[model samples]
Target: MSVLSAKFGHRICGLKDGRLRDIKTSSSNVRNMEELEAERAAQKIEYAAQVKMEQRIHNKLKIVKQQFNSILQSWHHSMHQLRGKVPGFV
Candidate 1:
């Protein structure tokens, strides 16, 4: 026997309930698939958020690296200029 539930769906059946253990077991086995589906959706949302956060962190690190490289290049250029001015300094 099948039941109708607007929440679970239009029709519900316990095909895996072993014929519902004479109806009781069957109805029990007719669990709501909505729970499992809802959990999957939540997990997907969490994974997307995690990915977004990681991308943001990666972008920030790239900017910092570029700034550091620029500073290092300027410092090297200054040292090179100073060495040229000092006759004894190689």
Candidate 2:
């Protein structure tokens, strides 16, 4: 059996067989297309925020690495200069 409903779409009969879960009862509680679109918008916003945060972290890491390398090079240069000043230092 089948029922054509303009408000709730097609309703299948006999399939329910007097079962509670098989019946929709009403369209009020059922999720609509608008709700699904809203959820997708929220997810896209969340994803963009996460990507921005990750990019900031990556940029900070690069700056710290550059500073460390600069310090190491300066220290090495000073050590070589000190060695040249020492007497009989090969």
- Highest-scoring model, TM-score: 1
What's model 1's TM-score?
Answer: 0.62
RMSD per candidate (Å) reads: 6.4, 6.8
Q: Write candidate 1's Cα lDDT for 1-89 as tens digits.
A: 55433333235444555453222333333454666778899999999999999999999999999999999999999989989999887
Residue 77 error for model 2, in Å? 0.7
Which residue pairs come into collision in candidate 1?
20-26
User: What are the runs in model 2 whose C-alpha is more than 4 Å off?
Assistant: 1-32, 87-90
Which pairs, if any, clash in model 2?
none
Q: Write model 2 residue lDDT over 1-90, tens digit each, in one string.
A: 343332343244543455322245445434564578799999999999999999999999999999999999999998898889997765
Cα distance off (Å), candidate 2, residue 82: 1.7
